[model samples]
Structure formats: structure tokens, C-alpha cells
Target: MSELPAGLVEFLESAGWGGAAIDPIPGDASFRRYFRVRHGARQAMLMHAPPPHEDPAPFLLVAQWLTNNGMRAPEIYAQNPREGWVLTEDFGNDRMRDWLDDNPDAEVSAYAGAIDALVALHRLDPGPFSPYDLAAYQREAALLTEWYCPAVGLSVDEEGYRAAWDEVLSPMLARQQPGVTVLRDYHAENIMLLGDPREGAPQGLIDFQDALVGHAAYDLVSLLQDARRDVAPELERAMLDRYIAACAPGPEFEADYARLGAQRNAKIVGIFTRLYKRDGKPRYLELIPRVWALMERDLAHPALAPVARWFDANIPDELRASGGGTIA
Candidate 1:
């Protein structure tokens, strides 16, 4: 039995499941922890977000918003925001990756469902979320130099990197048409496959606490260009086509998607490196190469020309991936 936090124990007791068996679920990069609780015939998942490090308000608000929007987010059974704990419906251990692994033939349908969910989400208004505007995008893109460059013993002109990114991203962000809510981490791991294919919300969304207002294609980039898993190129193109046809976003959508994809992957590269150097999680280092590849692919788009030039000048092909901090 893993040690439960003091507040979590109290919250579970107040929720009438004090003595329930707690099975710790594997966590991601965030500070939030999940546990599957079973008492009698009832089962529920407890989300414990330690205060000062994390909060449950955004998760609760976004979950409610997604549910209200007719998409399937977890149902909050009970919540103690002050204590940073919430009990939500456990949609089982069937992750979208599970379905994709178990039934390879259903990849097309599964991705289609995800894209359709995004289309539905994009149509709704971004209630009170922060916009992923120019400053926000540039700040996130800076992570590459902030963490990754120094970790690999490579020198980066931080000012140059920022200037190049600004040149490309400023106009893109300024021209962004609002309305879509960009779920910051809309990848396979956070998406759960639930219910029948023909039914409502075949995809159950989680880890959307950081949802923000941004381009409709932002989440699409997050989904198709996942850092942890491989989404085949064919599926990527098909889903992009599906979204374009359904939304009719305009001719600039593809360019924006590619640009965001580059920006997002660059952020991930730094984040993964930071996870190892700062957070003491070395496993994320292995994914650095894959993320670099995705970044390269996205930079092929003309919209990312300036950003690509910065990378070519600073981070060479050999220095792209981490050397376990041994390259001096």
C-alpha cells in the first residue's frame, strides 16, 4: 500500500470510502497523482493534487466545461478544491493506446473519433481560458535553450533563438482567429477509449487542466505528432484532411498546424531534457530524438523558416539528441 497523503485520506473518509483499497495508478509528468479506489461494489478514482505545487481548480473547471460541451470528460463525483482532491468516475484502464494496440485495424476509426471530438470542441466558445497567444507561444518555445542546450554541453544564443522565433510566431499568433480551446496535452496517453464506436464520445478526455484558447489545429498537432507514441504518417494526413473538410478553417490552417507542430515539438524537446536534468527522470531522454525528428518535419513548412534557421545555426544534427550530458 503506497502512503496516501493526509488530505487524501481525510477526503476519502469524508466521501465515504475511507477504508477502500487504494491502487496507485501510474502518473505522468505532472504533480497530480491518481488512485483507483474500491469499496463494496463501487469504484472511483481519486485525484490528489498537492497544494503549492498543483491545483485542482483548472481541472474541475475544464472537466465541467468539456462535459457541458457534449464531449466525454470524467464526471466529478466529489471535490475538495482547497485540499486539492477530487473523486471522479474511473473510465477503466482502457486507454486509447490500449485499443490501438489490441485492435490495430481500428486505428482509423479511433483517430477519426478523436478528430471529430476536436472538431466539436473547436466549435464551442473558450469560456474563461487563457489564450495561447504570441507571448505564451514564445515563452514556451524558449524551453529549448532554457534547459536542453546547456544540458547537452551546447552553446545557444538565447537572444538569437528568441528573435528568430518571434519573427515567425508573432504574426502567426496575431492572426490567430479565436474560439477553439487548445487542450495543452491532447495525446494518446491522456485519451481513453470508452463506449461503442457509434456511440457518444468514444474518446474520454483527461489531463486537460492546462486547456487554453488557441488555434483549432494546436491539439491536432499534439495528437498526431505525439512524443510518446508513433502516429503513422498516413493517419496524420487523413485526420488533417478530415478536420479541414469538417471545419473549413481556411488555406492558412495547414501552415498554422505545421508551425504550431514545430513550436510544440521544440517545447517538448526542452521539456523532456528538463525532466531528466531538473526532475531526475531520465527515461524521458530517450524520447528526445523522436521529438527532434518531429520538429524537423514541422520545420519543413515555410512558416517555420526562421525558426529552422536558428536551429541549423545553433543545434547541429549531431548535437540534436542528448548525450546523457557527457558531450563536452
Candidate 2:
């Protein structure tokens, strides 16, 4: 029998879900928990984001902001920010990722549909969030050296790492403000394949509490260059073209896409290594090779020249090729 959290029963009663049955659901890469709540014929997903680590307030606010603006963010039925909990509408089991697995032939169309959601999302005036600024980018990019380097027992040039990111990212400093609500984890796994494709918001977006007013290219990179899955190169290009046709964010889209892709990949590598070495989760280590592949591809872009040079000098090809394989 799964034990309910303290006050959860009362909380459910107060939220009109009194005596609801709660079943645990697997959480994501964060300090949060989830449960499926059932009351009669109704089912809703409970987001248990305990504070001092995870905050449900931002998730609630951002979710409503999205729904109010005609997006398909989950509907929050009730919340206790103090407990970092919220009962939200269940989006069902069809993640765009699993949907793709069953419908391999539908990959292109599924991605195209996902891109449509992105297009619709970016068109909206962004909600309140901190800027994904130069300092933030530099801080994140340095994580590669901060965690991954030490994990692999290689002492890298941390200063060069920051310098490279600075050079590549500094040019776009003016492109900072008025960015769209970047669903920071806007990948297939986080997207729910809701009903009819022709209906209102065919996609149900989730895991967006970390959203920020950042480069429009950021989420596009996230979707195309996924860390958890492989997106074909040709399809990646096609989707880029499709998004360009729809939103036309700017002429600098391609460069920014590559630049941010590299930066985000670096962050993921560090975080994954940290998950293993510091948090005792080794499964994430397996994803590092794929992330490195994507990072290298992004680094090939002209806009990533400075960072590329740094990687060339500091990180040996054999080390990256090992894919954290040698790391304990």
C-alpha cells in the first residue's frame, strides 16, 4: 500500500476530491513527485512538487497563463503552493514520443504537428520569466567542465570554456528581451498527443515550469536536437524550414539554433554526469554520448566557432567518443 503524504487526504477533501484514490506516477528529472488521483469516473494528475527544491507556484502560474492565452497547458483544478502540490487535468498516456514509436511512419507528420504547436506558442506575447541571458548561458555552458570534466578525471581549461561561450553568445545579446515563453523542456516526451489534429491545440504541453524569456531558437533546438531521442538530420532541416515558413522568427534563426543547441547540450552533459556521480543515478550517463553527438553537430555551425575551437583544444575526441563509458 502506498502511503499518502501528510494532509493529502484533507487536501483532497478540501479540493472536492475527498476520498480519492492516489497512485504514484514516475517523476521526471527534478525534485518532484506525481500521482494519479481517481474519484468516481474522474481522473486527474497530481503534481507534487515539494518546495526547498521544486516550486509548484511557477508551474501553476505559467500553466494558467498558457491556457488563458489559448494554449493546451494542463488545467490546474487545485493547488497548495506551501506543499508544492497541484491537481491538474490528466492529459492521458499518449506522449508524442511513444506515439512516434507506434507510428514510425508518422514521424515526419508528428514532428510537423509538434512544430505547429511551437509556432502557435511563439506567436504569443511571452509571460513573465527571467531572461535566459549571457551570464546564465555562460554559467550553464561551464557545467560541462564543472561536472563532466571532473567525472571523467580530466582537468579542462574552465576559463577557455567560458571565453568560447562568451564569444559565440555575445553577438546575440541584443536578441535577449521579448523572447517567447520557452518551454525549457519542449521535447516529444513532455508533449501530450491530445485528440483531433484539426481541433483546438492538438498538443498538450507539460514540464514548462522552467520556462524563460529566451531565444526563440532555444525551444526549436530542444525539439529537433532531442537528448532523449534521435531526430533525423533531414527531418530536422525540414522542420526548421517549416517553422521558418510559419513564424519567421528572424534571419538569425539558424545560427542561434546551433549556438543554443551546443550550450544546452553542454548543460545536459554536466547535469547527467551530476545525476550519476552526485545523485547515484547512472542511467542518465548513458545519454551523454547522444548529447555529445548533438553538441558536436551544433558546434560545427559558424556561429559556434569560438566554442568549437575551445572544445577542439580542451576535449579530446577519444574522451567524447567514450561517451562517459569509462566513468564509474
Candidate 3:
């Protein structure tokens, strides 16, 4: 078991919730760590984000944004900004992936709710209340290069990658789909199954510290072109259609979707590579082929042919091959 940081026990006690049994939760790629504490009938989750590497402000801000917008994210019970620790309502471990594994038919319905949540976020007025802005979008997109490229022992052709990114993004940005408070990681794993029968509102949402202001299609690609799970083609198409119809993106919808999918998948390929080589998480490697397949399909679209040709000529076969197996 990972060691709990010193003073965590004391911190919990000071929060007025003593006598609670604490269990360490697994760590993710970020500097943040999670813990579960049980105190009689009441339970809460504790987040330990060490200084410099992690900050609790974005989580707090976005949690407020999502909750205010009618989503069922964790409610912050108590917090200590000095230590970067937060106590929040427990959302449970039954994520949407596990729930769908048992009841396959519920996949469409559950995912529909997720898409609905996305639509709600998109439709909400971004007045003084919304915190999303342009800088955050660029930062999140840059992570694809920062985290993923070096892990494969491959350097991105900086000039080529930028040119390709611009070629694909320019037109979509021109039409500028109005920005929203995008929950950058709106995939199945982040969503939770709430009640025992598991048929009501979703209970949890995690890994949202990187929220951004960007295109409507960005989060959709993150959901449909998932690295951790295989979203069915029919379901993916249905969700795409649902978003298009719900948002009424015009003639450029298909083109924007195709272009954004390629951009997002390329970033993901780099990310998955980094996860295996740098982060010591080889399990993500298995998802590379699926991500590549998404890229291939997106590239096949007439709108993205130029970017497709560039990838085929520039990205080495050996590097792509390495994505399927252990990084070495």
C-alpha cells in the first residue's frame, strides 16, 4: 500500500471527522492522490495534491461550475487550501464502464445521458459565471506533444506537426463553434453509476482538472475515440448525430468532426506512448491500435486528406509498431 502522507490523519481529524478509517486509493498520472474514509454511516473522499505539482483551485472551480449547471459532480464538503487537500462527497467505484460491462443494453442510454450532459454544458450561457478561456484550450492540446512524443524515443517533427495541426484546425476555428465549459475528459471511465439498481443520475466525475474552452466536437472525440475502451461504431455514430442535431452545427459539422477527430487522436497517440514509456503504465499501450484506427478513418475523409498524407509520409512505421507492444 502507498504510504499516507504525514499529517493527513491529523488533517482529517481537524476537519471534525475523526475516528474515520482511511483507505489509500490508487494514484494517477497527475500529482494528485485520492483516499476513502469511512466514518459510521457517512463517507468522504480526500484528495492529496502536493505543492508545485498539483493545485486544487481548478478542481474547486470546475466542481462549482458543474454543480451549478445541474450536473451531479462531487460536492466539496471541506477543504484546506494551504495543504492542497479537499474532502468531498464519495461518488463510489462503479464507473460507467463497469456498469455497461454487466448490462450491455444500458450503454446507449447511459451514454445518451452523458451526451445530454455535454449538450447542457454547451448550451449554458458563458457569462461572468463561466471560467473557461482560450489559454486553457491551447495548454490542454499541447499535452499531446509534451507527454506522449518523448516517451516513444521519438521527437515530433515540430514544423510538420504544427503545419498539420494548423491545416486541420484553421477551418474549424474559422467557423468558431461557440465555446463552452468543456469537461475535457468526458469519457466513460470518469462517469459513475450512482444508486444500487444503477438506473438514476450519474454519481461521480473525476480527472477534470484540465477543463478547457474549445470546440464542441473536442469532447465528443474524447468520448467516441476513447483510448481505454472500445465504443461501438453504431453508438458512436448515434452520439455524433445526437450532438449535431442537438447543437445544430451547420454544413461544416461533418468536416469539423473529421478534422477534430484526427487532431485529437494524433494527440492521444502521443499521450498513450508517453504513458507506457515515461509513466510506467503499459496497460495504455493496448489502446494504441484502436486510437490509430480512429486516426486512419478520420484521415480517410476527403477534408483531411492533406493531413493524412503528411502523417503517412512522416510518422515512421517502427514508431507506430512500438505502440502495440511494450515500450522499448
RMSD of 3: 3.0
Q: Give the poorly placed runs of model 2, Cα more than 4 Å off.
A: 196-201
Q: In model 3, what is the error at residue 254, expressed in angstroms?
A: 2.7
lDDT of each residue in 1-328, candidate 2, tens digit only: 3476676777788899998888988777788888889999999998778878888888888998999999998988999999877999999988988877887877877788889888888888888888888888988888888898887788888888888788899888677567788888889899898863434338899999888888888998889999999999999999999999998667777888888999999999999988888888888878888998899888889999888888788888888676644666
The CA lDDT at 315 in model 1 is: 79
Q: Please, what is the whole-model Cα lDDT of each candidate in the order they appear?
A: 0.85, 0.85, 0.74
Give lDDT for model 1.
Answer: 0.85
Superposed Cα RMSD, model 1? 2.0
Candidate 3 lDDT: 0.74
lDDT of 3 by residue, 54-117 (tens): 8888888888877887877799988886788999999888888888888887778888877877
TM-score of each: 0.95, 0.96, 0.88
Provide the lDDT at 220 for model 3.
88
Ranked by lDDT from best down, the candidates are 2, 1, 3
Error of 2 at 284 (Å): 0.7
lDDT at 3, model 2: 70
**Per-residue alpha-carbon lDDT of model 1 for 1-106, expressed as tens digits?**
4476777777888988878888998888878899999988999999999888999999999999899888899999999998889999999887887767887877
Deviation from native of the Cα of residue 324 in model 1, angstroms? 11
Q: Ten consecutive residues with minimal summed lDDT in candidate 3?
A: 127-136
Where does candidate 1 stray beyond 4 Å?
Answer: 196-201, 321-328
Worst 10 residues of 1 by lDDT: 319-328
